[model samples]
Target: MKTVICLVHGAGHQPLHYKYLIDALRRHGLTVAAPPLPTSGYDDASATKTHLEDVARVREYLVPFLEQGYEAILVGHSYGGRIITQAAAGLTGEERAAAGQDGGVVALVYIAAFTEKEQPLTPEILGVPPEDVNPATKLLWPEAAIRAMYHDIEPGRANEAVALLQRQSPRDLDGAAVCKSSDVPVPKRYVACRQDRVISFGTQLQFAEAAVAKVVAELESGHSPWLRDDGIRAIVDCVLEFSRRRQDDV
Candidate 1:
């Protein structure tokens, strides 16, 4: 079966945010799927999106490939890690039996992501300021508005990054991870960003400690490495490496 590569971005982001990375992957003759989270397009302040909705959306995209026995490599960044965990669960051995599904996910690559389960998102988990937390779900966190997401980027690009930012409901942001780390039955890899201020190295380490990643790779990049040249290479390299290793295993 041919392998499938899908990219899911973090909160306040759409598939376009991964445009550069996608272009690079395609340049390598790789087919990439960048799914738009339903909760995205925050232009409508009246709507709210949940993590589970994105999970279901991603699962839908992977199901056809899985039913055909195609190996899938899910590359998720930031909040996307939660969706990948839930989306890939159905293709795992246990879920296969329960759902009678034919597809399989070969690997999970988390890029400076958030990997929490069954709890509300918080600054404690994300290593951000506690004041950023909106207890009433009254305010939205604009990821692009913050310089830290792509602090290393060129000046005007920051505004362009903000242009890609989505205003997310606190309800959507607070959605809990549906699947536990133990529920995900596949090789998990973590890409640590040494200079990540959003998800600090210590917090990423805390996530790794709980779930035990099979491989831990590092890059001297900020939260959004896909935005940087080296960061894009690191991400593409990590996923391709994992895919190659999986093929070799077969």
Candidate 2:
């Protein structure tokens, strides 16, 4: 069997956000898993550490699956993207060398995912002033506004989504600083959102370039591409193609 696709969610969001994408991948005969992060009541620093820890936890859960002769493709969105990148970097050189043959992660698909060094999670990356980078600085999202962030979600479902929103820590904002540098040799694909208000299109392009992936697809949706049909199709198609390519290489 091919490796399953591990989906990672962004900060202030949960795995539930990727429901549409997960279902679509499943329909295409792919296994998917999306784990939640530890951002509830965390400060920026603590949240950043927790993000790495979350990556470790996910890797641990995934190891047994890999050991069982299951390969995996990691897919991350926003903060989830950052977590997946760290996880990929954390893999030892020897471990990465054994991928695709037995049970190892074969590729990484970053849906608005973050890249190390090239686009560190600094205040500048977020397009915010140093003084405004504080988590306690009051970044409030009303229930309605939060729903608006997800375009296709119905009002009823949006309310439920808002309930899952957690207060992101400022440390998470600074956490990208401590990421150890590692070359991601696995194949990668970056899905860029053209009208993303949270992370700019330019930043996504820069990240895609840094990832050194062979393909990059742009969606004219907002930050949450999963909320759009065309965006979801783009992601599903990319994963399927990447998986087939990996399988063919084997």
Candidate 3:
């Protein structure tokens, strides 16, 4: 069976963000799954709790598929990357040990995603000082920033992307602060976007280093690499190649 590639979307964004990447992976004869995450008002404590709950829920749904003889690799973008880390932490060592065979999630891929040890993703990227930053904050994408970040995307596509932005609860940011995972011995990769405004490239690199990812690639594009064919291809190819190498070693 082909290893399953489970794509987790970032905070406030839906699975639709990964449509192009998913299609490309499928074209290469890889199995892909992108699941939508729950969205609620920013700064709502209850909503934030629900968001984390939803992350676990999605993992439960995928677990059975894995048990049914399918190997899977968890791929996460932005906030979704944080969620996958939490979900993977929830699994027992035995479960992860079992999945290690066949290159199924023998590694994790984070696309401009946050790691527990990285700088906080805040709305202050607009240039406000940290002291002025609020725990319950929301950042709206400015038109100019959007253009710079997603230059490869079509105008219409970029406009549509705006609709996917959600106001994340303050708790979501808080959750990431205390998140921790035992080193499950799975290889990890971090795809950094050098021009990202939402999450600083420096922060992403720092997170990758803290997480101890085996491989790290920096893209010249913005936060959303899916809009660029080359970026998407690089990610999919990396995951596939990593999976193959793991299987061979086993």
Candidate 4:
């Protein structure tokens, strides 16, 4: 079966923000899906959406591909990590086969995302104050946002990426991980951004260890590593290597 890589974005972000990384993945002859979450967008709709809606949106988008026998590899970023974990429940390849489906999720890859290893996102965890949220849009890290999410990115490009930021529901930060990370039966890998200010490197390691990620890769970038060429290459290499390892295991 073919593999489909689904890249889930974090709060206040859309697929456009990951254009370089997505394009690179597709260039490798891989089918990639980068869906915008219901909890994020530039409208009032996003303010009302919650974690459950985010998970449902992803699963709903992938259902057609799964039924078509295309095995999926879910890659979550930041808040997306929790969504992937829950969205993958009972959707493993084996589980799908048992249910008479041709394909399903085969693995999980997290990039500076939340997991069962950590508590709900807090101001302290983000290295920001509670007041950092935008009053009008409810977006996180509104002030000095570049420092927290794109410090390692080049100035010109980082500004372009930040211009696409949208509103993120505050409810997501308080939502609990309904499913245990260990309970998700699949090959797991974690990509930790070494210079990430939004999610610190030390905290990323803790999440990876807690989830018992079989593989851990490091990139010399901040939270939004996909914004640059070298960072995108590093992430692409990590994912491709992990996919190969997964195939070998099977």
* Candidate number of the best TM-score: 4
Instruction: Report how far off residue 35 is in candidate 3 (Å).
Output: 1.7
List the lowest-lDDT window of 10 residues for candidate 2: 173-182
Worst 10 residues of 4 by lDDT: 116-125
Clashing pairs in 2: 3-71, 3-72, 43-171, 44-169, 44-170, 44-171, 44-172, 45-171
lDDT (CA) per prediction: 0.73, 0.67, 0.66, 0.81
TM-score of each: 0.85, 0.80, 0.80, 0.92
Q: Which stretches of candidate 4 lie over 4 Å from their true place?
A: 140-143, 173-178, 245-250
lDDT of 4 by residue, 188-216 (tens): 88888889988889888888888787546
Clashing pairs in 4: none
Which segments of candidate 1 are over 4 A away from where they belong? 93-102, 123-146, 173-177
- Screening candidate 1 with a backbone cut-off below 3 angstroms (N, C-alpha, C), the clashing residue pairs are 66-103
Per-residue lDDT tens digits of candidate 2, residues 1-250? 6668888777667677678889999998888877666654334543444565667667876776776777788888876766777776635323745553357666778887676523555556566445543346223355433533554555665566666566675555444433532465567778888877567888888777776754468888777778677888999988988788767877
Candidate 1's residue-wise lDDT over 1-250, tens digit each?
Answer: 4677889888778888888899998887676778888766656642566777788889888877777777788988888887787787657734675676655787888888866545345666555666654444322244524545777876566567767776554556446567777778778888889898777887777776665675467888888888888888888888888777766866
Candidate 4 whole-model C-alpha lDDT, 0 to 1: 0.81
Pairwise TM-score winner, candidates 1 and 3 = 1
lDDT of 3: 0.66
lDDT of 3 by residue, 1-250 (tens): 5477888887666677678899998888887777766543334443545446646666766677666656667788887777676666534334555666322345678898875523455555523345433334443444543654455667776777766555555455444432453344466788998878667788778778777764457888788888787789779877887668756865
